[model samples]
Target: MILHTNDVFKVTRPEDIFETRGRFAYFRVELLSQKGNIDVSLKLTGRLDWTFTRSITLTRKTNDKGVAVFPVGRICESLIQGTKSNLITYVITASEYDHAGPALYAVPGFADREILPEWGDGENISQFYPAAPCIVVYPNAGFEQSLFFPKQTGELFVLTPSSTTTEKYIGNSAFSPIIPFDPAKIPSEDLGKPLAVGATPTDYNAEIRTYYDYCTKGIFLKWTDAAGIPYLYRWTQESKTDEMSVESTYHQLDDTLTPRDVQNKTLAKRYTLHSRIVERDVFNLCRTILGCQDLFMYDPDVGNWVRFMVEDSESEDTGAPMQDLVVEIVRYEYL
Candidate 1:
């Protein structure tokens, strides 16, 4: 359909990030200066396909800036309205006096600025909101061709991009080990239950594990959908401060044959990472995985996925542009 690019009613919120059309957030639209005080209306769908299959309509007049913002709505109680996909689409529509006109996309529009969670924080995972995975494309320059992780249905697995290129984890989504390993060894919600003893993989994948050294790796947060779209999060550039602690648990034996000392059980390394300084978007992106009860991290030191925690209970945010983050993590998955 032909969209009216020069319409008086416009949406100026979801300024494109990278090459993506808009950020996944609320909808906001502004009226032309000459059209000030005019009524604006919006209809959003609970699906991601951008179709107005569901009917959710609202009307409001423009403010001084010719902009109208939608309230977060009663996410706690609102009945979600339709049974579309997990993702929701906000389609702002407007006309001079609330008369039927083209959709906000027909005009130009933006999304709400704040990355505030539409479904609230990780506080309630069982809530109706679903954190859909998004894909991003990387800039291709001089190098081997880029291959998306979580490859297509029948794509063969390739370990290396090229001889010169190091084994890289392009698709930052959960990965499957190159070679078969104990399912009990893998963590992270990406890989569900452990496989049967002799069962071959009929499902799943992993980040590269071959390339390893004594040195630490950069904290490059990443995510890519099966489509190969990439989303990179470089928080605080790199952490400025780091802290670690260890704890052990074991069973006591009162039997006369047993020794007085309770043998050490396991050493779970708990880490606290303090960022140098970062933007609010980085803060929000970092929180995407906080709701995962089975969240796991790949420990280069041990070359395995270990149970990971963000310590979200104590995390904080103030909405300012520049800020610092205190990330607490725990990594303990070893023999």
Candidate 2:
């Protein structure tokens, strides 16, 4: 009997050629013999490692169409475990009538990305929400709340909650309570305002306008996705701030300064992300999501946006068995 493989059977998915996990490798063979009931045996052999090799054999009679299809799925998962190398040299051979010598077909499989846990809709690991510009207020003993801010800078009128307030603590450091002021209390009398070097009382208005510009100049951070779409979030010091306190002792004669203690502190920003990946798109995540590291992000404490990388990720199953994949990501980052 004469046998050959079809061109369609040789074509493979790109991921299957690279990463075999979560995919199947298939091949078809056709026999040219006219006789029926001819017994044939198919054999597949491959190296699992330098010290061991594995082989599987299946025997059957060719169909009326003279075609036999082999679906080898997840076999790589078992053979590839605990192996240092991802490269596997394999051969598929067949014999007819139990006396025909083995016909040899050789191929090589290269392992690409490491296999991750199976993705399911219920396995989504992140939950994301659209964030807005606001001050997240956390009192010493009460639930946290948010204060909205306009994009423009202006005199801020602070509001105090009716309940008694205490200092807020981050780590071991304490932050003073936000001072509340009434909008009507803004001083209009310019008695304490500074004057320009050579300006008389009539020119105070111009000097005040120049000073306002200097005080308002500050840098703001901007965050964007891998596609360069900007995030709708902003930060402010009132919501969070970094503080450093140092204490030093000085010697008399040499005027040498000795350090006693120092404390550094800052509050971090966190985000919850919710997303989905269909079965067809799951294999491409390495390139589209995890691979892009230069994306922009917003910081709530700084009142500006800045560039950030995904520092950590966590996932969970979000669907029933054998369903599409969904993931929720709780992302953590630093400025």
Candidates in order, TM-scores: namely 0.31, 0.28
Residues 1-335, candidate 2: write the lDDT tens digits: 12334332221222212233322344455555533444445454545555786666765665776556655544543554454333333443334222222212111222223122221122222100011111212122122222111111112223221111322111110110111222122133322332111111121111111111112212222233232112221112222223333334343433356444433333344343322233322222222333232444434477454654443543343543322322212233322
Score residue 83 of candidate 1 by CA lDDT.
32
Please give the lDDT score at residue 173 for candidate 1. Answer: 17
The CA lDDT of each predicted structure is 0.36, 0.30
Distance from true location, Cα of 306 in model 2, Å: 26
lDDT of 2 at 156: 22
Candidate 2: stretches off by over 4 Å: 1-24, 34-36, 95-335
